[model samples]
Target chain A: MTVLGYLANGLVFSSIIVLGSIGLSLVYSIADFANFAHGDTMTIGAYTALVTFGAVGGLGGAVLGLPYGFFLALVVGIAVAAVVAVGTEKLIYEPLDVDSIGLLITSIGIAFIYRAVIQIRFGSDFTRFGIQSLRPIETLIPYGVRVTLHDVAIVASAVVLVAGLHVLLQYTDLGRKMRAMADNPDLARVSGIRTKRVKLWTWVIGAGLAGAGGVFLGLFNQLSPRMGFNLLLIIFAAVILGGIGSVYGAMAGGFLIGMITQLTPFFSNVVEALPIGQGWLATLLENLITLEYANAIAFVIMVVVLLVRPNGIAGEGAT
Target chain B: MSLLADPKAAFADLTRPERWVLGVSVAFMLFLLGALLTGALGPTYFLFLVGLAGMYALLSFGLNAQWGFTGLINFSVAAFFGIGAYGSALMTAESSPIAGGFNPLVGLVVALVVALVLALLIGIPTLRLRADYLAIASLGLAEVVRLVVLNERWLTNGSAGVRGIPSFFKGWPVLSTFPETMPGLRLVVIPGSPIILGTSFWEALLNVLLVLTFAGVTFLMLRRAHQSPWGRVLRTIRSDEDLARALGKNTYSFKMQSFILGSLIMALAGVFYTHLNLYVGPGDLDPITTFYAWVAVILGGSGSNRGALFGGIVIVTIREGTRFLNDFAIPIDPAPMRLLLIGIVIVAVMRYRPQGVLPPQRELIWPSAVDGGGTTETPDSGVREQKGGGGDE
Candidate 1:
């Protein structure tokens, strides 16, 4: 039961990583800039969700009395996504016009500006939305198997988002244009496609997904001004490990990273049974590795995978 | 065709009287230092600042040889610096099973050897991929190193840090021999009468000798290297990689060498850092430390060895000065203003004079040489140079 509980927890965590990184890949593909602000886009969404839910009287006043906090998160998430989408294109991405070095420098500037603004306003401390909503269901599972309603939201939302992405890319005319442009912008432009429109639509959907992922993440963890900044490294590793521009690769990379992190403690328990048993290794990790640093576990996975396969598991163009 | 092909013309041009002014400037500095010692200023604190700046200049020289010469953006300076400090600490001190069942001297040697191996480890994999991947990977690697340092308390003493190091240059003894705590003087606050970073006279004396030895070696080696054919290849690679490749050079190996060498130099600085503080902590090597090096190199003019030294002095002075200046009844908030000023300097230099001050591989040609081709092959070749990192392919 504990293993299963761990698996559930892993999946919940993986869903957020996958979602966050997939946006990274999309923006990288479209804008051709490593948007350092992509993670902050998540912060913006999380903060917006909090504000939106507050306006809606805490998501519990609805008829079903179901976990409506997530429902509120969706609306606010989309709105934040739309705002950043239009804003970045108008204010940041479009103005830069795909110069790699310029884009890189400007994105760094954008990140600092975003961080400074967030800090000035939010005061650099962790704030949490209530988690009492998940307490009762967590106690009922055997193997002491525990799952929060927030975990349920993350897993369920991830499935819905991934499916929606797959269908959108496969079935829609807009996705068709985006894929065409991603393949070759010159050819797409020559083929009479409106690349700018496709890019705008891409950012809207991509950043909206980032926003939803942020809300899911913030619900599980606490929200701080620099909350998503550290997580960006792990997310980038996932994106690269998955493949630079692939969505599904990001998903696989995320879950792989998630399981590796959870399984470290699992390894310690297994080793404790050995003859030279040093429970010290596990206890040392617990004492020394801060929760903030747990995010970097994904980078090791990424560096290893990147060295082995720069093209990623799905290969190029396939993502 | 003129100066570009003739090394004699460039060497002869440096013999002029006005050019001697730059040489005389060094001598002038020596005289001024001599005066400041006996004069009203005393120059104790200023000398300390200069010593620290000289150490940083060596660090900047290493970085300049890497980034200025090789065109790499090493975002991992702090990690390498920490590695060096830990290396130095372990080498010069005594340790027991208390620190991972191994001695620090053994760890120090192991650390330096692994550093070169680590550079190759980081370089070979990422070098074949995008350059930015190296930047990202290196940043990630720094976090891993920091985490390992923190977690392996068995090795690093964990976040509380390792302390009680035997000082290599402990203190100056001769100049500070007059003990104020002696019954004759009665000058002691309590006893022993401490001065010079609050170290005993012997420790300060030792530090001066050690700092001078390290500084002398760095200054000479960098000067010798600057004039070598290898340095010429580096300048060419920085200007245009493909052109260098077209000239029958393998750019990658040189880049790898520069990276490892630069990292080793930073490691040396790290050793001094650990000994100076008598401790090693994870938080000591932050990104700000790396940027300080960048500021030094840029402020000093990227390719100039002497410029790096001067730049280090200027930047440290600005940083320390602004902090000290906060004590006055100033009406301005210099915190954000200072950051904005630094940012502007970066942007301004990049826009106007990207070759930086004291541009290396000095060959006087019109702007046309900035493009390798004649007027005939105008359009496509020009486009290629910009997009393709000026490979001349």
Candidate 2:
């Protein structure tokens, strides 16, 4: 309703992309494909949270506290999503071992399987995290901008996860291996870096992030089979616009693209409600752009970024 | 040894592998042809499904040209197909606030031209990128096209879709008056049968014929093109653009040509599809359409035109045949299961035989010796290399 609401919404939306794009950029850097199914993997993670809550609701509520139970669900979601991601790589992608294009096609197949399985099990209906039960705490920021507790939780978790990732990449041996592999798989192998192990870890970290991102996204709005697929283009835009395979770039691009996507529609609505009683301009603006153009906006941004800098803003070159 | 050394016998000699290949191919073709003929004869629904399969075959053929031959990953097959369907439907629909009310022939021309132009526009800027980037960009482009169709009510009637577009040969005197003017032509294959030649039946028959004609023409043209110098250049680029460029070829121009040609063919499929259904909708242009064609191309073999056709029919049959799942007493909905199976099939195909049912064949050039002294590496191997390294200058 208010411009601040849109700003808050944009930050929440950008955090999800930030979380999701890290895994995507990681996998793209190391595995050498876009992993078209990454979005669906995020969906699976969100569904994991749903299943977790359903199974442990009584025990978690009775034993651990409410917040702890919810936290437990998020952890379980991250674990299950990681396993599924690794399993897909082993069963489908690793065996092919062809090229990026082959892997891309294989990922598409995996995406279809993931989507269809979710639809079959869940019946394609919209589900939610019962955020209402939380009776979310709202606080007013500067300029009277209201923010909810759910938004705070999502943003906080994203910050923690991203920082953790940054520490891992900068300091850990496994993270160094991943970076080396991403830089040059052949050279990494020649240097006896155990590329396979790095790849395994890549999926674990990437898919785990996807799962957390999915849960946050579901919390932000609703959960459905289409949730991840719908946001796939935007996630892709963020990944590419930031520079493929660059973690920090993915984060920056995610926020930039997310703000643009959400804020464009918000601005459009605001302008349309203005007291300028001109009918034709409103009609023209409505036709030229609408909220549904969110996907288009992402796409256009990605294309423009690619045209200007083929490797993306952060990319050194093709990974 | 004496029998093997006989010069006269050697003239007709065939390798054991060659004979096996011939036998298996012929048998497969016969089986498919038999299945199609029998199904068409048995039920009216059979004709529709079979015709639809033929249309898919055409779609795969177009994809085969791009991915199979040119090593281009096109995620916009559905967009081009949509262009074909909507282009024709908008032009030929009876004059309304939104439609042009032109003849279907004009619609066909417009569809081809639109497809060509769009392909050029999308390809020119993006084709030089890496294969994965192109895939990403094309995927975005497809969504853009579908979104445009969904939102532009003034042009595409929004999401409700255009309906009741005139079918092919609607109100044509030759077809409408066929029963009276050509009594002999009305003879049914089933002698003395009570089945009367109805207008719907004729339309179905004509559609089948039309699809077959398009498939046949597309297959022949593609085969010829691939065998020509132009096709060879495409293969060279697909294999290694650097090599092609070093050889003094303008690889960009060639890639563009391949892209546009494949798109033109895909658009043709879309035109026939609209006439067959007599409707066009944004739903018809989803990513799933592109996926279906990709399955066909992958299953059949990417570079082989015949393989593309084979893959199309097999994929379509699997798709249509799954409708029988309704008869089973499954607790859950069968629709999702069908898609799940298709997904598995694509994964399985990629894993076990990435080359497809038939590995793309090299141009057979007979020489004085069985092993030709050729210095050039085969295109199939080149296309299959680690393409991840591509897209960088």
Number of the top-ranking candidate, with DockQ as the measure: 2
**lDDT of each model, Cα atoms only?**
0.65, 0.81
Give model 2 RMSD, 1 decimal. 7.3
DockQ of each: 0.20, 0.59
For candidate 2, write residues B324-359 as lDDT tens digits: 555555555666776787789889888888877766
Which portions of model 2 show Cα errors greater than 4 Å? A58-67, A130-138, A141-147, A269-286, A315-319, B1-42, B95-97, B171-173, B176-197, B329-332, B362-393
Q: Which stretches of candidate 1 lie over 4 Å from their true place?
A: A48-102, A130-133, A136-140, A196-203, A270-297, B1-57, B91-114, B165-168, B171-220, B223-227, B239-248, B291-393
True contact recovery of candidate 2 = 0.68
Task: Give the docking tier of candidate 2.
Answer: medium
lDDT of 1 at A75: 73
- Per-residue error at B18 for model 1, in Å? 17
The TM-score of predicted model 2 comes to 0.87
lDDT accuracy of residue A88 in candidate 2: 81
Q: How would you encode candidate 2's per-residue C-alpha lDDT over A170-194 as one tens digit per residue?
A: 8999988888898889999999999
lDDT of 1 by residue, A208-271 (tens): 8888878878876788866777677878887887787777787777777766565555544554
Worst 10 residues of 1 chain A by lDDT: A58-67
**B94-144, model 1: which lDDT tens digit per residue?**
552154324434555666776667677666765554656666777777777
